[model samples]
Target: MSEFADRIRPHAPTRDDASARRWIYVPYDRLTDATGPLTEQPASQTGIVMMEALAKAHRRPYHKKKLALILASQRHFALKQARRGIKIIYEFTPGIFADGLEQATRHHRLSALTMMQPAEREMSLDVEEARVRGIPLQLVEDTTWCSTESDFDSVFAPTTKHFLMDRFYRRMRQKTGILMQPNGEPIGGKYSYDAENRRPYRGQPPVPERPRFHPDSITQEALHLVAREFPSHFGTLDGFDLPVTQAQADEAWSFALEHLLPHFGPFEDAMAHNEPDLFHSRLSALINISRLLPRRLIDDVARAAHSERIPLASAEGFIRQILGWREFMRHLHRRTDGYRQLPGQRNNSSSDDPYAGAEPSALNAHRPLPAAFWGRRSGLHCLDTVIDQVWREGWSHHITRLMVLSNLSTLLGVSPRALTDWFWIAYIDAYDWVVEPNVLGMSTFADNGLTATKPYVSGAAYIHRMSDYCGHCRYNPRKATGDASCPFTSLYWSFLDRNADNLSSNPRMSMPYVTLRKKPASELNELRKRAAQAIEELCHAQQASPQE
Candidate 1:
C-alpha cells in the first residue's frame, strides 16, 4: 500500500491515564470544518504528518503526493492551534477519524473535552463514548458554517420519523427569507427552482478562472515536509490550499460565495473532460474538517439568493447541496445499517467493528480487497487513471465520479472492494462515512440500490455533451462503427444491450432502453467490439507503464 500511512502508526501510551492531570484533548479531523474558533483544540499530535513527510522523501512520487496533501493539510490545522497556545496533541491513528467520544476519551485519557462539530452522528458517538468512558463532553457550537445544530434541529423533535429536507429546506427559506416575495411567500410562490439548474454551458469560451492561492510559507513548509516524508502516494503540492486559521477559511468561503455561488446551480451537475472543479464548491474538505461551517455558508448564499443578489436557481441549488444531500447523508449513515454489514454482506454484527459484517457473514470476499485490479489485468485502469485523476484534484465533480470512472469500474466488472479502496486512497475529502456511501452504494452498486436507484452508466456522447473534454479528446463520440468511435460509445450501448434483460423492465429505465433496443443489432455488435478493444488498450498502456 501507501507508504505514507504504512510507515506511520499511532503511538499507544505505555502508561495508563491513572496518573495524568493536565491535558487538552483534540480530536482528529478529516475535514477541518469542525474545528472553528469555538472548539477546543485536540491536545496531542498524531505523527501522520511527519510520516507523510518521510514517505514523500522515499517513495514513488504519486503515492507520496496524495498522502502528503492529507498530512500537510492536517498539519497546517494543528500548527494553527499551537500558535494559539493550546496544548494540542495529534494522535496518529490508522484512520483519520476521531469519530466517537469513546474513542477520544479512551484513547486520550480525557477527563473533559469540548467539540464544535455539526454532524449529529459523530456527536452522538462522542456522547455515548463519554458516557461509557466516564468523561464530561460538551457539544460546543461550530461557527465555521452559517447554520447550527440547534437551528437545523429546531425543525425536528427527538423522535420524529417523517422529516424530509423539503420541509426543513422551506424552513430555511423562511428563516433566511432569501427568495421571499415582498408578501412573504418564497419569490415566485415557490422555494425550490431546480428546473433551471441543469443547463449545459451552451456558450462560447468564457469559463471563469479559479483563483489560485500559491502555497504560502506555512503551506510551503508543510508541502516540503510532506514531499520529503511520503514519496509513494499521489498528487502535487502545487495547488495546496490548506486554510490553517478560521480567518483564512472564511476568506476562502467568501471567495466562493461572491464569485462561484451564483452560477453554481446551473453548472453544478455539469462536468467536462478535465475541468473537475467547474463552478463547484471546493469547500467539502474544509467543511468536513471544521475549517468552515455549512450553515453560515448556506445562510449567506441563501440570503443572497433570496434577496435576488444571486439567482434563485443558484441559491436553491446550493442550499439543496448543503441541506438535502450532505445532511441526509450524515443521518442516513447513523440511522441505517450504513456502517454495518447488512443482510448477506458480512458475518460479524457488532457495530463497533464496522467491517465486522452482519449476522453469520459470508466469506470476506471484500476483505483482502483484490489488488488484481491494480495488477493491470483488470483492463479498466480503476487503480491508475482514476486514482491519478482524483489524487491530482482533491475533488472531482459527482458526474466524473459516477459516470466515467465509476461506470467503467462497474461495466468492467471490477469488484466493489477494489473500486472503493481506490476511492479511499485518492479523494482528499474521503472518510469512511461519506466515501462509503458514494463508493459502495452509488458507484459500485454494492449497497444493492440503497443510495441510488440504479447504477449510472454512460459512453462517450453523454460525457461529450456535458463538457469541452470531447473537443480535445483523443477518441470520437460519434463513431460507434470504428476505432475512431469512443470506447464509451460502443461500451455504453453494449452495456445497456447486455443489461437490458434486467434493466429494461425496470420502470425508471424502460424509456431509455426501449429506444436503445430499436437500434440495429449489427451496430451494437460493432460497438461492443470497439469497447473491448479500448479496454484492452487501456489495460496494456497502464500496465506497461512503470507507475502501476
Candidate 2:
C-alpha cells in the first residue's frame, strides 16, 4: 500500500465492525448535502469520508486564507457530524482522490458509498475513477443548486443557438417565482435594476465596517497546519478571519443584510483605495462550502426587501448575481462541451473572415503574465492595490476584478489560461467552473465573444472615473504616449487598431471603429509602438524579479 493510503484511516466511530453496510463520501464542498445520506441510514451504519487532499492544494499556489478557510470549514463540519453520532472518516493524504477513496472503502468495510454529484469537472472525473476501480459508489443529485441538469437540458433543448443569459435568467425567475409580482411580472416592473447600480462612490455616506470573526481554536489549528504545509503559498496568514462554522457564516450574512445590502447596488461597480470590500457580501466561500445555501439566502433577501427595509434595486441587484449570473454560468457550462462550441467560432473557424478563420488551438494570448500579478508592485495603483489585497486577504470586490485586473490583462494580451489559473489560485471564491467562464469568456473575450458581447477593455479614463487609484498614480489616464502615459490608454487604442479587421464588422464595435478610422495613421502607429514598449517594459520587470 502507498504511504497516502496508510494515512487514510478512519478517525471517528472507532468500532471494529468489519461489516459496515453503507457509507457516504462527503467532499469538502458538499458538506450540507450529506444530510441526504445521514437521513437515509442510521448514524452507526452511515460513515462520512472527508479528505484533506494535499496533492490538490499544491496544484496551484493558493492563497493562505483560501487554504485555511477550506481546511477549517471541513474540520468544523466533520466535528459537527461526529457530535451528531455519525461515523466520520477524515483523511489527510498526499495522493490522488481515487487512492483516498479506495483506502476509505476498505477501512470502513463499506458495502456502498453514496455521494452527491460533484460541482467541478475534475472531481466528477475522480468519482468516475473510483467507480472503475470497482468501488460500489452511487451518485445522487446535488440538491444544493436551485437548477439541475434536467433544468439546463429543458432550457437548451429547444434551440441549437448559443445560450443567452438574460433569457435563461428570466426562465429561472419565472420558475422560482423569485422577485416577481403576483401577476407574474417582474417586481418594480423590471427584470434588472442594473442601470441603477453603477453610481461611483464619492466617499459621502461612510462605508460600514466589515464584520470579522476572531479565529477560534479550530481555525487556529487549521491556520497553523496550512502555514507549515504550504509556506511558499501566495498569500499571508496575518489576518485570517473567515467564518468556518455554520453559525458564524449565518452571522456574517446577517451583518451584510443589516449594514451593507442597502448600499450594495449603487456601489457595486465602485472601487476605492484601502477599501478592498466595498458593500460586497463576502459570503462566496461560505456559500461554496455549503455553510449557506443560495436559495435560502435569496429568499431571505427578498423577504427583507418586502418589508420595505432593503431597497428594490439592492434586492434586485443581489438576486441577479445569484439567480441570474451564477445559475446562468453553471447551466451554460452543462449545455456546452467546454470550448468546442464557443460563440462565434464554429469548428474552430469564424464564418465571417476566411483569412482570420482559423482559431489557434491554444489561447490567442502569447504574452507572459506579469510577476506583478503575484503581488509584486506594478506601479499602477489600481493593479498594485488589488494584488496586495488579494495577497493579504484573498478577496477583492468584482469591480476591481473585472474593470482593473481583467481589463489590464486583456489589454496586455496576457494568456487567458494563465490569467484564469492565477484567479483560481488567488481568490477565496474561485473554482475552475467559476473562473474559466468568467475569465476566458467574459474578461478576456478569448472565447471569441461567447460570454460577453464586447471585450471589457477600457482606457485608463474608465478606471480613473470608477476608482480613486488614478488620483495617486504617476501615470496619466489621458495621455497615450510619453513617460507619464498610462499603459491602458495606449493599449486601448492599439487594441482597437490591431483587432480592427476582426471587430470592424461587429455592430457593437462600430462606434470604436469609426473613432479608429478618424484617427491619423501616424497617431495610431505611435499608439501601437507605445503599447509594444509598455508590454516589453512589464515583461522585463517581471523577468528581473526573483522567482517565487
**Count of clashes, each model:** 60, 0
lDDT of 2: 0.78
Show where candidate 1 strays beyond 4 Å. Answer: 1-24, 30-85, 90-110, 113-187, 202-205, 239-242, 272-276, 339-389, 539-548
lDDT digits (tens) for residues 1-548 of candidate 2? 43223323334645454355367788878767334566686666666888988887887788888999998888888777776667677776798787798887777667777888787766877787788998888998778888876766777764545555777788888899998888999988999989898888888568888778898877888898899989988788998888888888889999999888988898888898956688899888788777888999899999988997899999988998888788777666555543445544555434453212223222257577888886667889889999888888888888899989889888887877667778888899887567767776778877766666778888998998888888889999888888789999998888777777766787888898898889898888888888998888775564422127
Q: Model 2, residue 516: what's the lDDT? A: 83
Candidate 1 per-residue C-alpha lDDT over 40-133 given as tens digits, one digit per residue, 9 for 90 to 100? 3233421111112232123223333345445556656555544543334444433323333345556655655555443534334534645555
Clashes of 2: 0
Residue 269 error, candidate 1, Å: 2.9
Q: CA lDDT of 119 in candidate 1? A: 50
- Model 1 lowest lDDT segment of ten: 46-55
Model 2 lDDT at residue 219: 80
Q: Rate the local accuracy (lDDT) of all candidates.
A: 0.55, 0.78
Structure candidate 2, residue pairs in collision: none
